[model samples]
Target: MEKFKTLGGSEGSTFFFSVERQKKWERLDGPIGAFVRVMPWRHFGRKNLGYLFAILHGADFFFDFDDDNYIKVDESTGKPVEILPSTTVLDNVMVAMSGPTAFNHHPMMKPSIPAPSWARGFPWEYIKDEATEGEPAFSQSIPFVSKLNSIGVIHEGATNVLVPKHAYSPYNAQASIHTQPALWATLLPTTVPGRVSDIWRSYFAQCIFADSNLRLVFSPPKIEQIRNDHDILADFAAENDLYTKSGKLIDFLSSWDSEHLHFPQRVEQLWIDLYERSYIELDDVVALQKWLEALITMGYKFPELKPRFRNVALMGQFNFADFPNSMTQIMMWSQKMRERFQTTIAAAPLNKTQLAYLETHRIDAIPARDLKLRKRDHLGFYNPLSNLMRTLLRFENSSTIEAVLYAHDDALLNLTELSEGKYPFPTDKIANRIKGELSNAAFVDLRTMPDRAKARTLSHRVFPNGTISDIDKTIFVNTSSELKKQIPSLHAKYKQWGHYYCAPGQQQMAMDPEFAMYLDPDGSAWFPFHTQSDFLIVPTKYAKPFTEAATMHLKHFIWIECAFGKIVDILQQQLQAPTRLVKLCTGFGDRRGRWDVINNHDCQSESVAVFHPFKIRGRFDEFWAHADEINFPAYSSRGKN
Candidate 1:
C-alpha cells in the first residue's frame, strides 16, 4: 500500500477494504464521498469490490490481485525474485496472439519445475496440449516481428511476437494490468457467480482488444499464488457454465458484423445480441447498459486510434470576382469546390477566417456563465408559449379548468345534458323536424361513411357537380377515418365554400379537417366569424393534414399538445386565415357523466337549434326538464337559420 501510494504520488491511490466500508468511507466528504455514493456497485457488498474502486477513482491502469497472490521468492536466499530475464524482447506479433495459441500451464513456483496442474479457470480441452512434462525450453531463434504494433510475449524464457488475424484468451485476473482502452471490458456480469466473472471478462476484453487492433501480451508469471482456503468442488460448480459455454459464446460473438459500429456501440450491441441469442440472460444486458452509462457518466470517451480531421476548408486558389453577383454563381462555385476537393481538406492550424468561422459556428462552446444567461433567456421565451398551449389544450373536464371556472361553488355543478323548458329535449327529433328549416343546408354524416364506397357517396353530396360552388353551406358531423380520405379532395374543390365541422373534444377535432383553426380560439375573433350556432366553420383552405399522419403514436401528452399547437401556428402563419369557436355537443351518449362538465356549458346556448335536443342515450332527464331555462338561443334568433 505504501509503495503504491509512493508510486502514484499526486495521482493518489484508493484502497477499498471490504470490512466496514461505509463507516470508513463516510468520513470522506465532498467529491470523493459523492463519487462513492453514486457507484453502481456500492451496495453490491464485496462481489465487485475491486471494479467499484477502479471506476470510482477513474483509474488509468488497474492491476488486479487476489489476496492469496504474492511476489515469488528465491528459496536459497529467501529474497524476492524477478521472473523475466533482462534479455527478453518486448514487441507485438499477430500470429503468436492468434486464437488457437495454447494456454501456458507451467506452475508458478519455478519455470524449471514440472507440473501436471492447469490454472483454475482454464478449459479442460487444452490441458494435454499446453501442459509440459519437464521444464519449458527457450527458442534460440529470434521470432518474426510485424510493423503493426509492439506486443511482446515471454513464456518460460522463450519469446514470440506477431500480430494475429484473430485472438483468444484464458487470461486470469489474479495478477492482470487493465489498460484504459480495455476498462469497458472489465465490467463483470453481476448475474454470474464471482468465480467465472474474471474468465468471462477476459474473453470479452480479448474480443474488444482484437477488434481495436490492440496487443494482448502474455509474459512469464510475475506473482506466485499462495493457495487460499476454498472448497475445490464449490469452485468447480461456479465455473461449470464457462466450461460448457465459453467456446460457443466466443464463436457466436465472432460471427457478428461489428466492424462498422463504434467501439462503445459495438460493446452495447454485443450484449444485446448475446441476450437475443439466449447465451446470457436479460439481466446481463441490463447490467451492461448500466456499466456503459456509468462509463459515459464518468466522462470516459471510447478511444478510437484512427486519426480524423478536426476541421475542413476549401484549399484551391480561386477568385470570387470571376463569377457574376448572383445566387447561381455562388451555387456553381460551391459545387465546383465540392467536386474538386471532395468536401474536405486536411486540417491545419486555424487562420484568421477559420478562427472567425469557428467563433460563429461553435454555439455549444459557450462558457458556463453565458450558458446560464442563455438558459434564462431561452426559458423567458419558451415558458409563456408552453403555458399558453397547455391552457388551450386543457379539456373542459380538467380539474384545473374546473378549479378556475367554478371556484365559488362548494360542489361544482355537473351539467349532464343540453336542456330547454320542462320537456325532454329531443335533439334527434329536432334535426328531422327542422328539415324544412335547414332547406339550404347540406348535412353530411361523416361517421356513417365507414368505408370508401360510403365516403365516395358522401363526397358527391358535399361537392355537387364535382365543384365547390354548387354547395352554399356544408356541415360534416362525426368525422372518422373514411371521411379523412375524402377531405383533401373536398378541400381542393371547395376553395370558397363555407365548410363547418362539429365534434365533442380536441381529440375528435384533431380528426376533423379544421383542427388548425383553434390555435387562438379565444383571443382572435376570426374563429367565431366562421361559427354558425354550434358548429365551428372549417376553412378547408387552411385545414392541415391532421388525420393523414398517425398522431396517436405520439405517446407523451406534451408532444401531442406541442405538435397540434405547431399545426395551428403553421396554418395561421402560412395560410393567414381566421379561426372561430362555436358551441358543439361532444358528450351525446356519455350517461355516466364522464363528459358532463365539457358538454353542459353556457356555450351550448350558441348551438344551432336545427341540430338541437342533442340525443345522449336520453340520459339527462334532469337537464331536459330545465332545458328552456338554460337560455339556448334558437337558430332563427342567431340569424343563421
Candidate 2:
C-alpha cells in the first residue's frame, strides 16, 4: 500500500511494543474497527485485530511472529544481539531464486547440506517424489508486479518464503515481518483452522504480490524455532487442507482471469473460490470484506475492490452476499432481541404494555400458553424453555441450524479464552467445533461448570410410591388404574386416574415425572436421565425426537426439569448416537440460598465463565464489570493453530 500521510511523528529510538487482547473493546472507530466484534467469540480471525493495531499506531514496519520462536542469542555475549540490526541484507550481498518462487530456510542446516527436509506446508507433490525422498525440479513461475520495501530477506528465517509475483512457500505466524507495502496481507484468515490460518494468508498475499510492485527480501538468521510441545498428529490433522489443497490452490490462481479486478475483489474472489470448493467457510470471506473496509478507512489505498462481476453473473449466479453478514449487524440483532425479551416477558411477563413494546422490535415469540405452559406463574422447565424442544424441532424442519446452545439468559457465558482469571472459561473453540462434533453426537449437554454436581444429583429423580399426603406436598397425578376406579362415569377418553387419588397407608402415586412418564402408556417402569435445564446443545437430526419426548412429558404437566432432561434419556435408548454431558459453561442454577454472598460477589474471583442465573440485568452487569476486571493475556495466533 502507498503511504498517504504519517499519523504520528518519525520513528523513535525506543522500541515500543504492546500485546493486544483478542476481545471486543466496545466501540471501535478509526482504523482499528476490527472484526473482533463479528468474530465468533474467539475464532482465529480475532488475531487480525493486531494488524489494525499496528496501522492505527502508525507503525512503519511490523514484526509478526509466534511467541515460542524467540530471537537467537549470541553464544559469546550471551545476548540476543546487543544491538538490533537495521539491515537484513546478509554478507552485504543477495541472490534471488532463479528456479522456483519459494525458499525454505532451515537455519540449523546450510542450503547445500543434503539432509533435505520439507517445511510444514511444502507442497506434497514436490515432497513425494518417491524416487528422490525429498527433491523435485521446479520451473520458473509467472511474474507478479508488486513494490518491494526491501530489508533484503530474512535468511535462515526457518520459514518458507515466497518469491514476489511468482510462487509461494508457506510463511507462517511462526516468524515473519511486513513492511508497509506488504502490511495489507498481515490480516490472518478467520475461518480456516487456527493451525493453517497463516499458511492460508501466505499463499493469498503472495498471489497479490505477483501482481503488485511489492518485493520479498532476505536477511541473516535471527530467530530460532523453540517450538512448544505439540502433538504432531494433531498438527497434521489441522493442516489437512494445507497438505492436500496447496497445489490445487496454485492451479486455480494460475488460471484465475482476474487481472482487471481490484485488490479487494481479487482477495475476495480467491477466498470465494476456496469457499465454493469447500476449502474454507463463508465466514472468512465476510471477514475479509470488513478487513478491506477497515484498510480503506485508515487511508491506505490498494488496487481497489470494485469488480466487473458485481452486477454481471459469471456462473449463473453471484455467490457473495450483497449485504455482507457483518458482525455489527449480528450485534444489532442480538441487542434488539435482548431488549425485546426484557420487555416481552423475560424480566417479568406481567404487563401487556411491555409485551406491546416487545412486538415493536420484531422478536418472534409464541405465548407460553400456546405451548401448554401456565401463564399465571412460569415454573419447572428451564424457565420458559418448555418451548426449547419445539424450537429445536422447528430448526430441524428448516435444516438451517446445525447446533444449538440452549442457555438461560442468567447464566454467564465465558465462551472466549479470556473469561477473566476468576471465571473458569472454556479451553477450546465451541461453536464451529461443536457443530463438527455433532457428526458423532446426538447432542452435548453443555451445562455450566458449577452445575455438574447439580446435574449428577438430579440425573435420575425417584418416586418411591406415594400416599394421600403426597398429593398436596408434591406434584402427582392418579395412576390409570386408580382413575378408572375413581371416575368411571366420566368421558371415555378422559382419565386423571382419580385426581391424584391415593389409599390410606398404601403406596399409590408415582411422585416424580420420571415415574409418571413410565406409566403414560405401558405398565412397565422406565428410568430417565436428568440434568440442569439451564443449558444444552442439540443438533438438528435429533431435534424432533428430543422435542417429542419433552413435549410428551410436558403434556402430562410434568416439571420442566424432568421434561427437559428425560428427552435426552429417551434419545439415548431411541437412537444410536450418544448423548454427551459436557461442562461447557461457568454458572449453574441460581444460588438463592447464597444471596448474602452474591450481593458482594467478586466475579473476578470466579473462574472465567458464561454464568447463568443473572436473571436481573443490573446484577449481571455488576458481575460482568467485575468479570472484565481481570486482564486478558497477550494474543497468540500460532499456539492453537
- Name the top TM-score candidate: 2
Kindly list the per-residue Cα lDDT of model 1 for residues 48-125, writing each as its tens digit: 435645655566556666779896788888987654333343433112211132333334223454555655555556
In model 1, which runs have C-alpha deviations exceeding 4 angstroms? 1-14, 17-49, 55-58, 73-122, 125-165, 305-641
Score candidate 1 by TM-score against the native. Answer: 0.36
User: Where is model 2 more than 4 Å wrong at Cα?
Assistant: 1-26, 29-34, 74-79, 82-114, 128-164, 259-261, 303-641
TM-score for each prediction? 0.36, 0.39
lDDT of 2 by residue, 1-641 (tens): 22322322226644322233332332454334445465564566555666665675566556676768778788998989522234432233222222132334332224554655656666777553222121211222212222233221232342223232334556677656676666778877777788888877877776665445344543445787777999999988989988788877766654343544567777777778778877678887777777777777767656322111111100000011113322112222223222111111122222354334333333233334343444323443332445455555555654223544554434434333322221112212112112122223213332222444333222212234532212112223333344234334322322321232112101222444444544423232232332345555566577666666665555455544334444665565457545443332233345541223332333333332333344323242243233222211122211121
How many angstroms is residue 611 displaced in model 2 relative to the true structure, after the best TM-score fit?
Answer: 74
Q: Give lDDT for model 2.
A: 0.43
